[model samples]
Target: MAKVRSMFREVLLKQGQLSVEDVTTMVMCKPKLLPLKSLTLAKLENMQQAAQDTVRQQEMAEKENGK
Candidate 1:
């Protein structure tokens, strides 16, 4: 017995709308040099201020006790 094959094939396709995207790579630039105090220096100044405030409070307490 011999089998017969079909010459045509079936294909299914769905229509859709085209979409867009931002494919551009990010650009790099030279870093800026700001005239600002460093983070460590700023933190140190804050700590010194806090310590001074505590000392002032302690001195005031001593004065109040003496009165």
Candidate 2:
């Protein structure tokens, strides 16, 4: 279980999708939340793409607002 958790955490960290602190906090608070065994690389890629899209939208909005 620990190995699976670490593997998940490391992949997310390497992808730059989540910070180490964020992953650590979530894992510590909700140990059973992530179904690491069923997590696939494709799902991870989709999540990362979604996150990047969100950030891009936010940046564009901010630029429009002259912030």
Which candidate leads in lDDT?
1
Which residue ranges in model 1 land beyond 4 Å of their true spot? 1-31
> What would the per-residue lDDT of candidate 2 be over residues 1-67, giving only the tens digit for each residue?
3534453443424454653353444334644576545558778888999999999999999999995
lDDT of 1 by residue, 1-67 (tens): 8977779675555776656577999899999998599999999999999999999999999999999
For model 1, give the 10-residue run with minimal summed lDDT.
11-20
TM-score against native, each model = 0.51, 0.41
- After the best TM-score superposition of candidate 2, give how far the Cα of residue 23 lies from its true spot, in angstroms: 54
List per-prediction Cα lDDT, in the order shown.
Answer: 0.89, 0.72
User: Counting only residues 3 or more apart in sequence or on different chains, how many pairs clash (N, Cα, C under 3 Å) in candidate 2?
Assistant: 0
The residue-level lDDT of candidate 2 at 2 comes to: 55
Evaluated at residue 53, the lDDT of candidate 2 is: 100
Screening candidate 1 with a backbone cut-off below 3 angstroms (N, C-alpha, C), the clashing residue pairs are none
lDDT at 6, model 1: 78
Candidate 2 accuracy as lDDT: 0.72
